[model samples]
Target: MEKQLIISVGREFGSGGHVIAEDLAGRFNLPLYDYNLLEHIAEEKDVAHEGLKKYDEKPKSKLFSRTVRGHSNSIQEHVAQMQFDYLRQMANEGKSFVVVGRCAEYILKGNPGLVTIFILGDKDCKVKRVMEKYGLSEREAQQMCKKEDWERKYYHNYFCPGQWGDSRNYDLSVNSSRLGLEKTADMLERFIRTKMQL
Candidate 1:
């Protein structure tokens, strides 16, 4: 590969998006910044780390949010800006990496090496994956899947310019229900290689 490769993956909850990101990162020998983006923002501060975890993927307030220090960003807004700044810095410096979620596809738009992917699964597959992974009852898993997808949609809609799962926003969108996790990752790899001429 002559150029940097940045793969931004967005997945429905329980769609094994994170696992697929991990697999791609390992295969391509790139760093993956997933949930650890919180740690990057918190900067090893235990209290802030826990606090940010609690606010994970939450949207900013439309009404009560205010700007301080010449910007009217809520805490969530601040954290998101910081995360996006890091992603921008990385892309600008020609670093190759795989980043999961936090509207990265929108954040790093227009980079020549950028390859955005959204992974979604059928409702039954997603619910079953959540149940087995989290040791939850079927009803609990179903509720979790619904809540997570809703939160992700709201977060993206609130902060980003485009719909969260819209295929037009990404270079590729794959349904994990069809090929499953491993095969889906492989399929995405093929797309990435051909798309980027890797």
Candidate 2:
């Protein structure tokens, strides 16, 4: 059987990342896993729904012994690995889905029929968008963007071992600030169809 196409998106804060993912799913009639990945993991692993949020897009910060024999991973590490494996297994079972964040691109890298995309925009555009969307002042929006970007960077670097939002890691990268969400989604639909020869 042919492998299904999986588009995993990595994005910066206030980049319309979730919106784009939802739009893509709508355009292509594919299932999307965004915040729902957390719900699924929470149920399958017997982890509390709220408990899983602590690990969502967040990295572990504890120190562990580097050379200890029979070393075990931290709770967060173990759960993350489980979640990663679950996503892979689900994808393999013929779910053509759009996955948002959570280092999903890295988790599915080099897998057959996988398309990794990173969505980004200028800092000013991101700040403005966040401000308009959340009814926050410019300064507040900028601060929020800065803090979220830091968290995402730390999470990606600690888990995936690379610079987040680097275009090289993705099959295609798009700037939603210029094209807007709808057009960005349209462009992605065309891009994926052409790439996958659909």
Candidate 3:
């Protein structure tokens, strides 16, 4: 049987991380679990897709709620759990897939086939990308970038404190600004090929 291969991508906001993840998935012919993970959880008759969509990747929910499994958890906690649970199920089923954000790296820790990658770039580079993509002024883009990055940090650290953006935790760390998005994806494909063969 082939080994399970999971690529967990953690990235800074506006770093073109999602694009790179898509590139990697295409090169490897693996499934990318982003919004579809939410859809997976939403299939449960009792779980509300709108509820998960509303809070997807936002900061920790302040209100505690009961999970369908009957555990008392914050809304954020419950939603995050349902996603992680699905990832585990996929892994256990020996499926290889790539997951972006939602702290998949930490949540899927201990899986031998997991490849953890963190994507970051210079502030100017990221801000420029945001401005171009969102058609916002420089200052507005800067504010949005700052707000989203902090929210992602707070969200990630809420579950795994002090772990976000720590280069030590990731098997590979890339600066898309330095390599450019295409080159970065090409380089990562090479790395994943060699890494997975071991």
Q: What's the lDDT for residue 15 in model 3?
A: 93
lDDT score for residue 154 of model 1:
94
Give the alpha-carbon lDDT of every model.
0.89, 0.80, 0.86
Q: By TM-score, who's the top model here?
A: 1
Compute each candidate's TM-score over C-alphas. Answer: 0.91, 0.88, 0.90
Model 2: how far residue 113 lies from native, Å: 1.8
Question: Model 3, range 87-196, lDDT digits (tens) per residue?
Answer: 88888878899999988888888898899999999999999999999999999999999999998898898777447899888899999999899999989988987998
RMSD of each: 2.3, 2.6, 2.8
Position 69, candidate 1: lDDT: 81
TM-score of 2: 0.88
By TM-score, the candidates rank as: 1, 3, 2
Error of 2 at 88 (Å): 1.3
Model 3 scores worst on lDDT over the 10 consecutive residues at 61-70
lDDT of 1 at 157: 89
